[model samples]
Target: MFQLSLATVSHGAVASIPLILVAPFALLLLLIATMPLTPPRVKHLWEHYYPHIAIGLGLVVAAYYLWRVEGGGTVIGHTAHEYFSFISLIGALYVVAGGIHIKVKGESTPVVNVAFLAVGAVLANFIGTTGASMVMIRPWIRLNKIRISAFHIVFFIFVVSNVGGALTPIGDPPLFLGYLRGVPFFWLLDHVIGQWIVTLVALLVAFYVFDRRSFARMPVRLRHESEAPDTWRFDGMMNVLFLGVIIAAVFLPDYWFLREIVMLGAAVASYRLTPKDVHLENHFSFGPIKEVAFLFIGIFATMMPALNYLEQHGHEFGFERAPAYYFASGGLSAVLDNAPTYVNFLKLAEVSASTGGGGESTPAAEHAAVHQLLADRPELVIAVSLGAVFFGAMTYIGNGPNFMVKSIAESAGVRVPSFFGYIGRYSLPILLPILAVCGWIFLH
Candidate 1:
């Protein structure tokens, strides 16, 4: 059995890490992006053993870091902590939100579809994108079952699953990671709401046009024509109360351990209290969350040395402008986990801000960079935050909800695009243009 020794990890003397160590991570991204395009047999074998591949690569990366620097241990410890908090939050929300089943009798008209996504946008800020997706996806699917298309799910991924989560920390994992690192919980709302609203509005308008055009392309006989109900019914309603308890715990002062325990208990209560029949109807299973939990282990570990290396030398890459930061974060986020990427760039920004003004940076200046960052935080933070959240919609694995929403749609029989297909067809032609506009409007 392969084992990772958490105890052996320690931050040794400050040592510069070589850039060569980033290859495994780059290769991992390449495999993920290109495998589906390979021949069927090759893709099948690769997919079947992808987890093993990820683990092997992660071990190799970790070993390299361990041998090279004492800081490897610190990276491991911090990663474990971040991974724990991340998976716990995801698992809790997935379990609890799965308990909720919203039923509204309606025909899935273009207008109605837009409304559903809009509501999801608002709800995501509080319940989180993953939870909001779980709660709303089934109903949206049911409403559009008659004329459902991949485009429906794609647009939903854009508006609800990613871009909509920009307002609060709980809204998305990357933002929440920032919160854990002493960023104010409400910082995104204060700094990013303008960009969020503009981006969301443009996407919504674009979706309406696209959906209308697509609907018109389909045969008239195939479309379901019905109105949204004046009222809606929610099953497993008590879980709503439990959801509140979990969110409240997030805001609790002190008692970090207690908060985690209560959150676990709350998740348990949700599972036990929710009817099995509801789960069956919702097609709720632990599969998606389990897959995420497993895959992200490699993500956090393999990313460690890369992150550490980036922290030391990131500013040297010469991405000095806010737009550059925006694109750097968002572009990678399209193909990678936004959480670590967010942290990587955040550290870069802080370090750069802390450095001497156009001169050699001293230790005291570097130490003071953190405070300086927060003072005029609006520009860098806005760019990074929006970039991470927005481009995370570009692919299935870009963000947690992107995958969850895809899995749920597949379970309901909507065929999502392949990884490259999503970017080439949906995200590139659709989201990319909108993102350029957002950059023009805000990041510049």
Candidate 2:
């Protein structure tokens, strides 16, 4: 069943996929990254036409695979299944979270802001970055609305949406995929807890510095007014139960689409049960999720050849050390969807281990190879896991939640950095250094 769901690219199909097939994926990414930065007329056209463009490009790849590749039907079927699961989980979390409105009175201080993000980081592990982001982003914006800046949104993506989820498979999609592949639930917590702490601390401290400066820049009267104690009220508390349903549904076996069925059912129930006023107060709309669904359809479809190419040739890249795996996986994760990137690197690590006299790399030997890699080369697994989750913050397209968060913030009238701005102004200059130190100190 797993093989059917995640069909490996056969050796014969490797040479058949022309390198030019990757062009659509690259073109799509270029448009996603640069379209927003374009002039208003162009950007407006993009807003209107992006769905068509995305779907059309995806069809190009889908057509190629169906016509040319062996077992292409199985591969496309796997991609479709993956897309359904991905959208179901994300859509369910979005709906359930949208039902719950967290109302905060008064403004936030840098200390309070730091604490809020810290708690958000922790909550990410339980309900997922998507769930936590949907639940907490509104309150976070309201808490600091008096002085909210792009940095606030960017840091939230950095800490809450990405790095914080490293502790458990429930925390990040890549880690969750690892769990599905037989990695123990607690393996990450046991191995990378220390590094997680250090990385979070570094990010929190950096956030504090930015937040403190933002706080201080406020007028004296507004600063004093912002210091008032914050009060909170949660409406639509019933959605919490539905949230638990969605999370629990994640553990259900994938056969017959049981997992997705449960998730979508819970989302429907939550949406129907929640009060209309609560949705109004939360300013919840389907626009954000709709955008994600459309763009990611293209991403999933277009990225198949890229992922397959990597799966085929990954071992050709001499990744002999943990740091090498860390940076390589991370660099790719910054662009590609991190989940498949994690899986491919894990396969590469398995191939590396087998070639180094660990075991055979045949299809029947694959399951044993995972266990062998875990027992003998756990560090490589750690690198792949950390790279996929952490570096997902590097771009809006890197993770599902990042774009949603940005869209939500923008809807709330908060200024968000453009895609390149996110990478240049924050991700590269700030987040990357901290992640680099972590890779150096730990994975190295």
Regions of candidate 2 where Cα sits further than 4 Å from its true position: 1-15, 177-185, 213-224, 335-344, 356-372, 395-397, 410-425
What TM-score do all the candidates reach, one by one? 0.85, 0.85
Among these predictions, the greatest lDDT belongs to 2
Off by over 4 Å in 1: 1-12, 16-19, 32-51, 60-68, 71-74, 213-225, 228-231, 253-256, 356-371, 415-421
**Model 1 lDDT per residue over 1-444, tens place:** 322222122332454455666777777767765675589999899768788877788888778667865556556566667677777777788899889999867566678778889899998987889889888988888877767888888988998999999998889888877776666777778877788888888998988998788777766666535433435788999998988888887787534566667777889999998999888878888877876676667777777656555555555777667898898899989887787778778777775654532222232332355346768655887778888988899887788788778878998899878777888998999899999888988877
lDDT of each: 0.76, 0.83
Candidate 2 on 100-136: residue-level lDDT in tens? 8889999999999999999999988877887788888
What is the Å distance of residue 37 in model 2 from its true position? 2.7
Query: In model 1, which residue pairs have backbone atoms overlapping below 3 Å?
Result: 9-73, 10-73, 12-70, 354-369
Least accurate 10 contiguous residues by lDDT in model 2: 1-10
TM-score of 2: 0.85
